[model samples]
Target: MAYKKETMESDCIKAILDNNLMFQEDIFSFVGFARSTYFDRSLDKSDAIKKALNDNRIKTKHTLKKKWEKSDNPTLQIALYKLICDDHEFNRLAGVKNDITSGGEPFDIEVFIVNGKNKTKKKD
Candidate 1:
């Protein structure tokens, strides 16, 4: 299919000019540009248009985050938290230490079986 120019929002144009890492998918979706068209345009489109598509991605993310936070559903907030939080790396980044001391003294760690089941038993 032939590439066709699509009308993009004025804000989107400004977004591209302001940000260097705008999400192309958001720009394409917002401007009704096909993926193929986007790639093709990337090769020949004016530098200004290219920059706008790249920079608009941040605006897209900001918009989504606002919606996620505003939603009344609990899961939406959790989803927003996941989107913003780096919990997986929090422990290392926060300088957390992994040391376990029992009653400030050495303790015996034992394993036992009961009813054909095994479980850990800690003793002081």
Candidate 2:
């Protein structure tokens, strides 16, 4: 069957957009479509689903932004800020990459033959 945009928007797509936590699987289950349909000959329908999902995400973000703007609660404000912004200090820390090199400090790792057998020694 061909992709029915109106029916999907009125039903499954509507439900998916209404729930922020609904994943692709949830949408497929709600729409009574198999997950495999997206990979087979129904790829176009899958693309439509993705576009609708993106639209819903934008709508959801806008709604959240409006609600966050109207609130006077400091904790709520912090939560929203944390959701949208990253800590500068943490970002700097995350960007620091530790390169493994033999240039920092000198250490003696040598094996010396003592008597007849080999012995490991460390420089003091």
Candidate 3:
């Protein structure tokens, strides 16, 4: 009763999307697989997801289509920015703006992801 790669991946994706937005490792565990296989499969999936995200960013920034819009509230805008900036691509592009030192301004966090995608701020 072995599952195929497509079945494994689809189950992994569903477990991820179905849960409370767990990490890659968490997703792998959910599907009862080892870390190695998860990492091997994740590399390609991560790349594809990131490429799609980049495309969305381009569309959001360059067109009047306005597929996505930030809230007008400074508080909400900053929160949304922090959420988007959590992505590695966004963090690097923004100089890791989300990282807070001991003596920096404080802000509220809304959504969080885990693993390399962890979005929670570490208390320094």
Pick the lDDT winner.
2
Candidate 2 vs. true structure, TM-score: 0.46
* Per-residue alpha-carbon lDDT of candidate 2 for residues 6-108, written as tens digits (9 for 90 to 100): 5654565565666653356666656655556544544435555667677877887888877886899877776676666655643554576454456866666
- TM-score for every candidate vs. truth? 0.36, 0.46, 0.33
lDDT tens readout by residue for model 1, 1-124: 5544443334347545555435555554444456666666553355666666544666777888899899998888877776666755554544684546677677778976667854667787
Candidate 1 vs candidate 3: which has greater lDDT?
1
Error of 1 at 124 (Å): 73
Q: Write the per-residue lDDT of candidate 3 for residues 21-119, one digit (tens) a residue.
A: 334545555677666766665543665334544555565454522323444566555545655654675666567556664466666669755556656
Q: lDDT (0-100) at residue 63 of candidate 2?
A: 87
The 10-residue segment with the lowest total lDDT in model 1 = 3-12
- lDDT agreement with native, every candidate: 0.59, 0.62, 0.55
With a 3 Å backbone cut-off (N, CA, C), the pairs that clash in candidate 1 are 16-52, 22-54, 23-57
Q: In model 2, which range of ten residues has the least summed lDDT?
A: 37-46
Decide which is better by lDDT, 2 or 3: 2
Candidate 1: deviation at residue 51, Å? 2.0
The runs of at least 3 residues in candidate 2 whose Cα sits more than 4 Å from the true structure, single-residue gaps closed, are 1-22, 42-45, 83-124
Worst 10 residues of 3 by lDDT: 62-71
